[model samples]
Target: MLLAIDTATQAVTVAVHDGATVVAEHSTSDARRHTELLAPSIRDTLRAAGLRPRDLSAIAVGVGPGPFTGLRVGVVTARTMGLALGVPVHGVCSLDALAHGVMADGERTRFLVATDARRKEVYWAAYDVTDQGVRRSDGPDVARAADLPAHLRGLPTAGRGPLLYPDALPHALPQLDVGAGALATFAMGALRRGEELLEPQPLYLRRPDAVPQSERKPVSTA
Candidate 1:
């Protein structure tokens, strides 16, 4: 069985893929509660699937272009659990998981996936939905919503961006968050094709909002 988890957006999603199909899943949209939500969601999903951590053959996670804290929660949990269970952990770009959901719906046209970057910017990617699967036709880049290329603006779009910047992505689809079930399915296909997956780490496209002080100022008696 494969366990998949994603906390790359406002949504915290987990799934249990029992080789043939996803037998159990859980999802909750709580931007402020990823740390609190992920663990129990994983445990419940596994229990619902009638499996345990030791039963998992592999762990797949969304190493995201997302908020530092939220991404850390999922990636760290995945890596820690993988270590304890003696299983390999694979990382998928959370954007690819969003795009995979679109392609799975039989979308045959090019589209965009843009999630909020929380600094009045977006983590966006362009994909071409193919018979085989979705391929990155353009970006996995970050930019201000209004500053995105005009050509990209006109593509059919997915993710929270449409909700966040309607004027930018006018043709947005209703799919808002990357589902872990889709992430699991994507990994399953990649493993079948003998494709290498990413290391289990956060894929922050930019530096975190918080940084260590370059130097501390001396406190002097005034």
Candidate 2:
């Protein structure tokens, strides 16, 4: 069995896959509540699947081009779970899951995966989708929403970025839902082929909002 987790955006998702099928999944979308929601969702999904942590053979996680805090929660949880179970942990690009969620097999399209990066910018990637799967063609770039259209014009798009910048992605397709199942599926396929998956590392594209104050520039009393 494979356990999948994706907290890359407002969406907090968890799933259990028995190699051939996804047994159960759970997800919630509340940007402010990732910490509070993710753990319980994992527990609930496992319960629904009638499985225990020991039943999971491996852990798959979505490493993101997402906000700093929300992305970290999923990666950390996945790593911790893998360590506890002594199982290998795999990381998939969260944007690839979003792209795969929408595109059909055997159909090819130039598509864009855009997720909210906040502060008027987007974390965006472009991919070419086919029966084989989504192949990233460009991007994973962060830019103001207004600039995206010029660079990513005329491609069908998805993710929370469009919700934040409607005009930037006018042809946006719906992809705001559970991504854990896809994350698991992607990982399972790779493992089956003996392909090495990405390390369970957070893929933050930019510096976080909070930065430490410069080493207290020696306060001097003259």
Q: Which candidate tops lDDT?
A: 1
Q: Clashes per prediction?
A: 0, 1
lDDT of 1: 0.92
RMSD to native, candidate 2: 1.8
TM-score per prediction, in order, is: 0.97, 0.93
Q: What ranges in model 2 sit over 4 Å off?
A: 104-108, 149-151, 220-222
Q: Tens digit of lDDT per residue, candidate 2, span 1-222?
A: 999999987899998999898889898889989999999999999999999899888999999988899999999999999999999899888887777676633355687878888898888889986666678888788888778657585677778767777876777777864379877887788889898888999987889999998787987899
lDDT by residue (131-207, candidate 1, tens digit) is 77788888788999889989999888889998999998899887899999999999998998999999998997899
Query: Which residue pairs of candidate 1 clash?
Result: none
User: In candidate 2, residue 15 scores what lDDT?
Assistant: 87
